[model samples]
Target: MNLFNPSKRVRNLYIKYGENPFVLLSKFIYAAHRQKWSKEEIERVISAAKKGNYIALIRILRSHTHIEE
Candidate 1:
């Protein structure tokens, strides 16, 4: 789950679904699982998604690249 790596699933999903909130949120959830994010972090992303904050969701996903063990 190296965040720096580009995920084929994500790319394929984007190709098929475009940049809709549901797709972005799904990507966030998937990345969060792979990255093993903290409960609070996952909650925050979920909250943003629930609120229809696509930008926030993208930001949160981007931030995942900086997460370290």
Candidate 2:
């Protein structure tokens, strides 16, 4: 699930949706692409979630309180 080497689905999404994360990383038909959360962002979420699992990240808030309210 390396964001570095995007999968075919990601490449297609990137081409159709462009490089903006708002699209490519939004709904790429691949959970891995969606879950390819950045380490920094994950850290922030971790600092907030405090031992949270990846499943709760969809809401972001549930995963990370750092998310601007």
TM-score of each predicted structure versus truth: 0.45, 0.25
Q: Report the C-alpha lDDT of model 1 over 2-49, residue by residue, as the tens digit.
A: 223453122222322347767766666676567565667666646744
Minimum summed lDDT over a 10-residue window in model 2 is located at 7-16
Compare the candidates by lDDT and give the number of the best one.
1
State residue 14's C-alpha deviation in candidate 2, in Å.
28
| lDDT (Cα, tens digit) per residue for candidate 2, span 1-69 | 221233222222222222333342233324323657555553443344224343333333321212222
Model 2, residue pairs in steric clash: none
Cα displacement (angstroms), candidate 2, residue 45, comes to 0.4
Candidate 1 error regions (>4 Å): 1-18, 52-69
